[model samples]
Target: MEKLRIVFMGTPDFAVGILDTIYNSQFEIAAVITAPDKPAGRGQKVSVSAVKTYALEKNLPILQPTNLKNEEFLAELASYNANLQIVVAFRMLPEVVWKMPKLGTFNLHASLLPNYRGAAPINWAIINGETETGVTTFFIDDKIDTGAMILNKKIAIDSNENVGQLHDKLMHLGSETVIETLELIEKGNVTTTIQTENSELKTAYKLNKDNCKIDWTKSGIEIYNQIRGLCPYPAAWTYIKDGENEWNVKIYDSKYIEEAHTYSIGTIISGKKEMKIAVANGFIQIESLQFPGKNKMQIHELLNGTQISSEAFVK
Candidate 1:
């Protein structure tokens, strides 16, 4: 197979892994398209995207497009004369950009196609308490994640796996799968499989602050999964009322205890060194947590330094 001229499009740490793989391979990466720098963190300092940083380190040409459909951006992209385009963890592209390449454009999705085919697949799969999920490579189409799949690799979701753990697993798995798909395309031996038709499809829409709030009304296992799914970033939060002030507590590591508890649902049960909350069927022990204006710490540490009110309840 000839050394193919490729253009890579991505913006997050997840996409950086695949770009690294391509950079170290025989394929020629003509240009990289990533999101423009945005203000972030305390003091709102300008921050470059992961892909842009990697591209700069490798001395590869870079394009930070505010809009993919802009004529100037499209004209510059077409100048790369790339045979194919690879997208991972990037914004949706218009057809004018996706169809610019000779081999068309393909995306590396974090979850298996036809399922979890939306924005936040890695988090949603864990949030819904799924036992298995996988990554897929597919040709881009008009609808999001609705294209025919070229390759897929399944991975088991451990019972105690959280979004952070699962995200790492899929990232490495996707890297390998993407390389394999690119090789198949180069050899003109790739086979495409259509996504299964279904009336009921699982959607992984973008998570918002309201969706991250823990709902104790759900079953013990459901609440447990929710806590784990949102841990580490955009963490699962709940308001705790302490007399006059309401404090926001972000819950991280947790486990559901099957043993019955006398406390009412939503009640905050605490020990001298640990904290637990009652759910519908059981109790969830909080392993790590953070209160408003506080750093993340283990329950034992928080219990030692802070006094929690006895009447406080998760709102």
Candidate 2:
């Protein structure tokens, strides 16, 4: 097989591992394409993407294009003479870009194709109470995630696993799959499969504040899944009201209590070092949480620092 000249496109930490895998492989990495640097954090310091940082360390050729369709950017990309283009955790590509390479561009999606076919797949899978999820490698098509599948590897989700844990698991899994898919392409053994529609197809669109808010009116199990799905980043939140003051508090970890409860939904039940929120069928014992302007803390620690009155309830 010819030594594959590959160009990798991705951003964020999730995309870093896969790019690194390809970089270390026998295949030649012609260049890397990542997002442009932008100011981040309270201080607004310029921040580079994780892929870009790694590429710099390895001294690999890097491209940061603000516009994919720009003539200059497109010309620079085409100059790489890459046989294959690999995309992971990157923005939607234009047809001109994905079609430039001799071997069409392929993406490594966090979830199985035809299901959870959008952004935030890891978060949505857990939030929807799914017991299993997987990763897929597919050729890029005109529509997002509607491409022909090259391969897929299944993964079982732990009962209490959050998106953070699942994210890492899939990140590593995706790297292996990318390597396998590249091997197939190099050997001319690629067999693309068309994705079909599923009756229970659930799309994982972007997450917003409204969707991330904790709905205490839901069943304990449902609320538990939602909480775990969004934990660590962009955490599940609820409004905590104390007299005239009301504010949002992010809930990171929680345990579901399945016993019968008469307490109204959103009620804050607390002990000296414990905090629980009453939901439809029971309560969710808060394990870890964060208040505005405060670092994340254990339930006990938060109890000591904050005043959660008896009348406190999640909005």
- Worst 10-residue lDDT window, candidate 2: 301-310
Which digits, one per residue and each the tens of the lDDT, describe model 2 over residues 1-315? 756899999998999988888878888999999999999999999999999999999999999999999999999998989989999999999999999998889999999888999989999999999999999999999998989999999999999999999999999999999999999999999999999987888999899999999877788999999999998888999999878889888999999988787888888988879999888888899999988998899999988867788898888
Tens-digit lDDT track of model 1 for 94-204? 999998898989999999779998889999999999999999999999989999999999999999989999999998899899889989999989899999979788999
Which RMSD does model 1 reach against the true structure? 1.1
lDDT of candidate model 1 versus the reference:
0.90
Model 1 stretches astray by more than 4 angstroms: none
Candidate RMSDs in Å, in order, are: 1.1, 1.0
What lDDT score is found at residue 194 in candidate 1? 92
What TM-score fits each model?
Answer: 0.98, 0.98
CA error at residue 90 for candidate 2, angstroms: 0.4
lDDT for residue 30 in candidate 1, whole number 0-100: 96
